[model samples]
Target: MDKIIYAILISNDRQDELTRLLSGIRGISDSNLFNITYNDISVVASDFSSNKIIVDKEFAIDYARVIEDLAQHFTLLPVRFGTLMESPDAINEILIKYYDEFKQNLQKVENKYEFSLKVLWDYEKCSGKIRLKTESEDQNAAKLFHNNSVSTEYLLKKIKEHRFESALLEHVEQLIGEISTRLAQLNPIHKFQKMVTPNIILDAVFLLEKHKKDEFIQAIDHLKSQHDDLNFLLTGPWPPYNFVEITLK
Candidate 1:
């Protein structure tokens, strides 16, 4: 049987306490959860028969819930869904091998919680406005294409559209800058993905100190007030899923 790993946690000198905590929470397939420890760190895992494991959305969520519960009291690196090993000794070998890196990462996230922010806008409305602005700015662009061959006209149109798209991206970057500026006071470690979709202009995640969560929410609420044209969807105080920087081979 393979054991599915949920998280890597710092048990410190609290193995007994960690044991008590695991006793109360069930893992995937309602299996009893337990820890395999080496020194100060441990792996939360449950018995999972590889042939019987169902890789489905429900099971994935159950896996995350187990990690979520562990993260409530321990600073942990959540294991990716479907991670499995043959034995506790194998798990112990990994912990011994990666002890320093794991300890460093645990220190990095010691008291921090992760939050996500997505900025959305009306695609048609925003693009329409941008097109108008681009046209107004480039009124003389049409004159440069006076030859008027079909190919020339087509290329010119594409150029203008490219300019409009570039302008929209610049606008999004500007909004990101504003958000970063507002969040500078809180000093979070963040990552961003711009224009993930036509309507989703900004997808961002932040790792902030746990005690600063309320202030972070208030900051986002204030930011929402400033940008009437965009919708801000902020989620979490979640485990630092997006911020995990390690991969166990």
Candidate 2:
């Protein structure tokens, strides 16, 4: 039977306590949970038949639940779902090989959690507003080239389209800058994606100290109040999923 790896955590010489905790929580397929240790770090795992696994919503949820439960008690690096080792010896070898990398990551995430924020707006309405502003500020290109040939008219249309796109991108960038500036006080490690969808203008994740969770939420609320035209959806205090950068071999 293969062992399904859930997370790597700092045991800190608490093996007996960890064993008691794992005894109360079940792994996928109700398998017993156990840990394979290397010095002060450990990998929480369970016996699993690789062939018996089914990739489905239920399985994914169960897997996440296990990690979430462990996270409440320990600082852990969540292994990718479905990670399996052929035997305990192989698992031990991995723990040995990646020990330094694992320790570094674990220390970085200790006492921290992650949060996500999505800024959304009505794309059509926002674009229309920008178009109106652009046209009002500059003479209509179609009117300026009314007497020109068809080729000239097409070129003018393209130019207008380009200007509109540029303006929209500038607007999004300004918003991102403002968000970063406002949240800088919290000193979170953050990642931002612009224009995740037509409506979702910004998608961001932040790794913050656990003690700062409330202040972070308050900061987001303050930002939301300032942007009446934008919708801010902020979630979490979850395990530092986005902050983990290690790739296990």
Candidate 3:
């Protein structure tokens, strides 16, 4: 059978114990979950019938769940949702090929975990409030209504709308900047996605020291004080999903 690789884990040469533990779990489609170990690292996997296609989201999430279970007992590098190999030998070859890179990555993330932070806001509410703040400037522009021709009025309205949009964008950037400054103090290695949309203003992931979990939370709470307009959604001390650095063919 073909195989789908889920993650790479640190085993410290304990392949026998790792195998014993893996024997109890099931992978996708009720297939057996297994591993491809080399020295102190192993790639967790499952039987994947190459011809029987199942690329749906529910199955993919099930795949993630399998990795999540193993991660509870080991530090691992999670592969992107669908990473398949032809056989155990192939995975073993991959382990050797990427051994140094994997070791370095493991070293970098040792005794640490990942956390995600997202901030959502009420689109209409925030936009309306922002419009009110800049309305004075807009009102002045509106009062400069010179030519009463249809095209002239349309152009003026368009200009006013563009100005309001620029104002909204600037306000959002300021919020992101403030959050970034606060997170920087936490000294975390992170990847941040900001201004994804008007409603989803920030989506960030932090690779933080395990012991600093509380400090990270405290930082968020303190940061929240300055922005009452946005909603903060923070998830994870997740197993380094965004921090993994190696790949398998």
Best by TM-score: 1
Q: For candidate 1, lDDT tens digit of each residue in 97-198?
A: 999988898889899999999999999998898888999867667877768799888888888888898998898889889989999899999998989999
Query: Candidate 1: worst 10 consecutive residues by lDDT?
Result: 137-146
**What does candidate 2's lDDT look like per residue over 163-230, in tens digits?**
88889999989988998999999999999999989899999999999999999999989999999999
Clash total of candidate 3: 0
Q: State how far residue 79 of model 2 sits from its true place (Å).
A: 0.9
Candidates 2 and 3 compared: the better one by lDDT is 2
Residue-level lDDT of model 3, residues 22-75, one tens digit each, is: 888888888888877788898898888857866898798788888888877888
Q: Return whichever of 1 and 2 wins on TM-score.
A: 1
For each of the candidates, give the backbone clash count.
0, 0, 0
Task: Please list the Cα RMSD from the true structure of every candidate, rounded to 1 decimal place.
Answer: 1.1, 1.8, 2.5
| TM-scores of all predicted structures | 0.97, 0.94, 0.87
lDDT for position 21 in model 2 = 98
Candidate 1, residue 48: how far the Cα is off, in Å: 0.8
Better of 2 and 3 by TM-score: 2
